[model samples]
Target: MAEKQIVEQVLAAPSRYVQGKGAIESLGARLSEIGSTPLLVADDVVWGIVEEPLRRGFEEAGLPVTRVGFDSYATAAAVDELVEAIGSGGHDVIAGVGGGSVIDAAKAAGHLAGIRWASVPTAASSDAPTSALSVIYTAEGAFEEYRFFPKNPDLVLMDTQLVAGAPERFLIGGIGDALATWVEARATARAFAGTMVGDRPTRTGTALAKLSWEILWEHALDALEAVRSNTVTPALEAVTEANTLLSGLGFESGGLAAAHAIHNGLTAAPQTHGLTHGEKVNIGTLTQLVLEGAPARDIEDFIVFTTRVGLPNTLTEIGLSPQDTAELRAVAEAATAPGETIHNMPFPVTADAVLDALTTIEAISRRVRAAHGLAEPTPILTP
Candidate 1:
């Protein structure tokens, strides 16, 4: 008899997660449990929003806090600078406050410094807060690479009032990100592919992915509507949890297939640089559905939810048209590059498949938009 293949199942998540209105009020005490001294990595914009509450909380807890600034992108040089600051400041823990880039830098810095970190996201823009990996970008804001750590964050604190107060686009973008967890997890499980931890998916991980999916479909629209009115409704709370905790756990443990790989590939086109990570990921998810030959109803349902949430359902909305063949091909090539998660598909994938799926999604999105009486956006990078 042939020897059986031994496949291990792995799951990863932050040690602790707290979410609610005024959750930042306890940031100091919560962080103190991890370490006494904390260094905050946040940009000026985020500092403007969170400074008073965070500082007051830390002061009330009698914990000394140091601060550092990060702009929009998490560059390697930025990580190095933060590592230096942590060392020189004798800081025991890190508090990353802002969007994905700022938090990603804090995670990378804390990992390098051999200290734990807390994620305090002001906006629900992406799922970078709870993952062990950081998406590094060029200083000019192009994709560079990912920096991974041996472990996830020590804690993740989301102040939903703060999130609800931010632009509704941020919440919608997070929904774009969380929407992929189940689709990709389903793909990975069917293929028996490895996850971020370099092992197969666990039943627990897959379950979380499915849960994330159901939560989004149920509550995403209500959450966006609540955010539009700057209210912390229960829908917003549930979507926030789905976007950060469940999506983070789901993607890391359940595995990524083509959606995120395609997001990375979209980065190769300078035309796409202006788009947000979740915006591009949404289109990539649609393209992935096409590449995998998903049911027509599934594809249409995805487009409906995506458009209703004000996310881009077509590549045309971001940039590029089939007329820009060279760039689209470049995107396809990058997506299928060796070691990309596109290979995690149940069946083999080719650059041609990726390229064709790209154009196909654009066509389908146009039809859906017409049905909804929404006009197609002008191609942003048309020659």
Candidate 2:
């Protein structure tokens, strides 16, 4: 194999993305382009919310769609089981209709089955709906490994009404995930790091990452407020797109850095299993900024905004304490483990440095909380 003179630029995303109220009602029509007999991947919880529209759509299209129950994390074993089950069912396509873990599991299973897959997110809880990679986890929910597919989902349909109907925590968590896009992308760009696509970031991917952040920075609070009132506004719509699509493409194509690496580190702690992916990633983003020696004002600004949106930034908030040296050290070690995206930082990263950065952010978070009289985030996660 000859070494290339330049790193190939990459920008990965779903082949098609559709978002609006009642978008899932059109799922049967859109998915027909990919396959006739499709498998719907969702758990009982998700099935309860989307069953009507999904069944109606398929029935109207005069097509057969089978349900694939998924309630666990996207573990390797789970993916293997799903692949075998799907192969036996003769499903030509798979469509995940739930949150991050379900979508990831569907993507992994569909890829292994050599069948196309679609994403039908009922909640904007994380940016997993449009990517080509499955973040496989352990049965206990610890970070396991990443499974990549040949392409992104064939269709990504985000029903804003359904997203709005979900518990507000989902949207908040999604915002947290979207917030990391720009921060991680900036670092990846700074270091010219490799992406999930096995290539360097493109200008287009970086631009989308920046846009995702800007959208959240502008509309997150408003979107949260609207969700609290059980209403879907323009702010909510914009935020949903930012969290689902922009962040998905940005992280996959633009590359990841310490933020996501730190999130994986958090998974090493069992106490944090209840927290959503975006919540952990939000904490990771703050830690990454600290590790980078970013401007104090920038860090404080992030704290201020995220605090208002209820992102947990302190050790205690995430079920860790400053006194828990062993656990914290474990997290630091995981963040700096071999092949972790923390290496994407322009500077060499060590577990000790990551540990120090975590401590620094705790103090910074405390200071910001005191100055603003802000309360710690409530409802750490949703069911």
Candidate 3:
């Protein structure tokens, strides 16, 4: 048998990112730089907020525009519908405006239609804006699979004012999503896992991941406060960039590990239905630390950071009861399933190991909360 060759490294990012208070107002000009005839896709709520400005801007720029409404999940059917619409209209560019689902649908549609695409995020909810990937779910909202595109979006435009005005939960959810970047990337580097970008982790990706983590720890609280007040402060801007741009590039080029895999596994439990992706990943991040036997100081620091920013540190917070052995085992099994990203860990991880980590993390979280004089720990049911 011959030894297999390993590719060295890969890095991927959007062609450009423009972010500020009035970034959306420049959408027409940005589109003109790429194509003259563009199609806009957004959900009802997003369309309501952005319609006038977008229409005015495109008209002023003398660009032809076609608008479509996306009100369903990012299923293959939805993408196909958008693709047909774009093809029939002879639109040259695709612009997605809204949250993760809307942006993902537009990206998949544009990829299928062979058109350049742009992402305009209305909230800082997840790191889905800058990546060259889309997560397709069943129409019923169950996890299906991730689809990778040939190239990243041509543009990612974020209006900080819009992001700030979004519900605070979305911002915190974004923080939780960004929170796992450094931890997972470090594990991926140690395991020598391939990134979503298709090769080994790049120095640039790892550096960005580290920077994202540092910014979250330094500015997350202030940013949360700023968003609550509907004000765009420097801290808010930094965290938004960290959660969207840096985390997007970092995760795509650096790779994913146990945290995200655990998140996927958690979806198997119906109790987690109400939790956001970042909220679930928040618990997965802590669970990963426990699985890796991370140093106590490091674990405590993360617990403190999550607690300060109102991220879920225990299973109960995410709607899982500790005593549900069968459900917990299912989650663990899913996490360790074949082809799951949990394999990206530096060491071999088993379902049993993940189960044990889940229990231990609950105990650790309780202790940390008690020591901090925060709310009393929820009673853990012995398995």
Candidate 4:
């Protein structure tokens, strides 16, 4: 039995990971070996920030490259643009370098190439870089269904220095997204039990998700300090990796639960449309915990960690008001779609209960934000 388990563990999708300060500079050579003249897809913001270094890397390695710039929107249109750029030119490989948007676009582009992709993330905001799935949005920026592919990334390159140097909000958002792994994975495991697909819910994925949560809970403060101080503390590195790589791979294969479902509900609000992906997911995680009957202490611990890290602890921050009860109800209903996140909860959840949880979550988030002297809650939108 133990031998069977060991054999199963060895069969998971493999990703070549490279981590360090100057790791990004070596990407051209590393990717060139796998495929000459790889297509590079990056958001405009990333190009402005890291283009010079990347250009130098390509020049130094004498690698042929085709660069495609995206506007940092992961919309279907953007994906189409990327595919068009990669074209029928027959590039040997595709590389996505930037945040989740660029990575998602690159992932889709590589899929179009009928080949594996190398993901280079400039921010640790979400797990998009490491997943075989792409959360493509509609052209108008509405949440769309997850797009699954036959394979995961060919490589995951993490330049800790570049990541540490990027805006602190990215890491905070990453933490927000990373926090969902344990919450979501556990919920899925409980719902489907041993029926989890393919070596997915692997003991490794489950263990990584739990450890990611623990690292976030215990070291979030230190991570925030590192971000503020512009230093890569060991805690920050661990948390960053968890958010960018581990959590991503775990959730893609392990499965999602109410946390992401709650995030999906955010699209119902125009105000939430402007928020970062992980930021919305952060609040969703809190709301999911409430639905899961998590203890007050455990939930509070999550709230405190989020509060310290600048994540939304309340819906009011995302622009939902008390009087928006009607809108919240509609959103809750949408979250309970069949085989969706809300249904994945271990306990039964009604739309009304979901509404109440959202209200509680919003209120708590506001209080935590206020106490930390963060942004004030804003008024909600009404027709």
Candidate 5:
């Protein structure tokens, strides 16, 4: 808000950025630019989807290649396994191919190996590819801490065909993740108005993050429908990029807040073990708005929109039972840490407030489910 604070936010760094339908084809050359070999990392399902085309591309470029597979995202265990595989495999360049988890693993492994890396996401999930940061998890898949880097991916790639074939849930989750940047960034800027942290968000960062949110809100419903129908409409493509690329940059450069805090709370609940990052964040975003004292009608609108698109709208939708009150309360309490999501809140947040919001959300969520007569809806949602 003050001139001094504005200056502090401008010092943040972001790296090279690129996107489009056929951008993946250039990865080989980009890898060359970064002096990286073609060491590909992907989830098991990814190979079944685009393995031949990718292998053929590297072969056509005459680049030596090595392959590594993971059972899940870039968890500590997966990273450990990849380190071993890469050590033995003698791969120099790393390419991440899949959704956020696969790309995240690739980035972490590539960084750990001290080699250049590229990213090829088959689903529009999170901005895991382009950022110079990684959300690390324990071997058992619990949140660890944020790992920041000086540089982002050496190369970034995407194939609309691959993304189009992904389940609609990924697109929905990605959109939710993307949209949170603007809301959270604004909240962060507001909180920093006269604080000791000063403002850590530049005008450019705030504007870009805001614009990304506007774009997502404008296209999300249509994009969700197109994704569900298995049709890659222009709207869907635009929204996907906005969420994955634009939002990723926004959160990293602009700063994140409570929605992300709530997302982090997922690790505290065993019942939420199978949730996707975006799915958890989707619900978390709603809770963040509630904690912000957002307009009741607007909060309800978000609830309906996310619910319609099959994003997780409730604790139950993401696999936690309404019966797990104590665990949920604990998570809410933990989420209110000063360094956690509270920094993004417009005012200093109390654990009691977070708990109240969480409680309210369960009521709203159950009411919505009742309207749809989706009785005995499976207590757990598939990630």
Candidate 6:
């Protein structure tokens, strides 16, 4: 057999990232840098919050703008609708303003339309803002596929005040999502797997992933406190940027392994429907640690971090019980499915191995929680 050739490495990122309080108030200037006419895509709720500033800024800058509401999931149909809505209007840019799904939809639409785009995240809930890919879901919210773009967003605009004013759960969710970057990147590096950017991990991606983990460990608690008070503090800013920018670039170019694969697999369980992406990834991180046979101290430290940030640290906390064997098996099978990034682990992974890891990690998490006097988590169930 012939040896396969691979690219050495790749690093990808948005061209511009601006973060600060009242950053959206400068939207017009930023838009002008890209295009004079931009299609603004946001949901009704987010539009209500940002409309005044967005319209005023554009007017002041003498830029023409078109507004459309993205009320559906990031489904193929939704992207098609967005494309049609863009129509023959001669829009030069697409700006997504809201949460992950809205940003994803906008990215997909922009890619299909062959236009540049920007991501304006109103909440620090996920690492989708700075990436060049979108997770498309079925209209009913089931995972469908990942859609990759030729380039990352042209701009990622973060309004710290808007983020801080969001409900604290969003920030906590972002922390949960950011938690897996280093662990997964390390595993991918060991396996020499190709990253989402279509090459080997670059030094920049590796450093960013490690630094993101360090920031979470050092600043997550303080950042959570700041969000609770609706105040923008240094800790809050650092964690928010770590969650969005660092984690975004890290995962895309550093690659993913079992943690994100497990998160995708977990979507098979209906009991997990109410949980956020980061929350599930947090549990997946614990499972990944156990799967890799990490040291007890390391697992314990991670559990403590998750607990402090109010992330689910156990199966029960994530709405699964020891007796849910069928669901567990489904998750394991899904995690180990063909094309899943679980194969990016240095070791060959099996569904049975994932099942065992899930069980063992839950037991370990319970022990850690008890030792730390943490209350048992009340499971979140979908109606």
lDDT of 2 by residue, 1-383 (tens): 99868758988888899999889889999998889889888899888888888788888888896887987888998889889888898899988888888889999989989999998999888888899898999999999998888899999999988988999988989999989999999999999999878899999999999999999999999999888887889999999999999998998889999999999999999889999888899889999999889998899899999888888888777887678789989999999999999999999999999898887777788888788888754445443
Clash-forming residue pairs, model 6: none
Poorest 10 consecutive residues of model 2 by lDDT?
A: 374-383
Count of clashing residue pairs in every prediction: 0, 0, 0, 3, 1, 0
Q: Global lDDT of each model?
A: 0.88, 0.89, 0.88, 0.75, 0.72, 0.89
Better of 3 and 6 by TM-score: 6
State the lDDT at 161 in candidate 4. 75
lDDT of 6 by residue, 218-295 (tens): 999999999999999999999989999999999999999999899988888877867888999998999999999999
Error of 6 at 312 (Å): 0.5
In candidate 5, the residue pairs with backbone N, CA or C atoms under 3 Å apart (3 or more residues apart, or in different chains) clash, namely 37-93
What's the lDDT of the predicted structure labeled candidate 1?
0.88
Report each candidate's C-alpha RMSD, comma-separated, in the order given. Answer: 2.0, 1.8, 2.7, 4.2, 3.8, 1.5
Q: After superposition, how far is residue 192 of candidate 1 from its true place, in Å?
A: 0.8
Candidate 6 achieves a global lDDT of 0.89
TM-score of each: 0.96, 0.97, 0.95, 0.89, 0.88, 0.97
**Which parts of model 5 have CA positions greater than 4 angstroms off?**
1-7, 11-15, 84-91, 193-199, 321-323, 365-383
The segments of candidate 2 whose C-alpha lies over 4 angstroms from its true place after superposition are 1-6, 376-383
lDDT of 5 by residue, 1-383 (tens): 66662245642433455565665665566566665456787667887777676656666677766667767746877776776777786777777788777777777877788877777788888766777767778767777777666677776776766667788778777877886788787887776531112346666667778888888778888877776677778887788778777776677667788888888876788767676788788878888888888887777777776766667777777777557778878788768765685566767778788888876887876676676564533554565
102 in model 2: Cα distance from truth in Å?
0.9
Better of 1 and 4 by TM-score: 1
Pitting candidate 2 against candidate 4, the one with the higher lDDT is 2
In candidate 2, which residue pairs clash?
A: none
Per residue, candidate 3 scores C-alpha lDDT tens digits across 1-383 of 99998678989999999999867878999999999889999888888888787778888788876788989878899999999998899988899999888899999999998999999999988888999999888876766788999899999999998988888989998999999999999999998898887789998998899999999999999999999899999999999999999999889998999999998888788777567789889889999999998999999988877887878888777667679899999999988999888999999999999999987787898899888877754422222
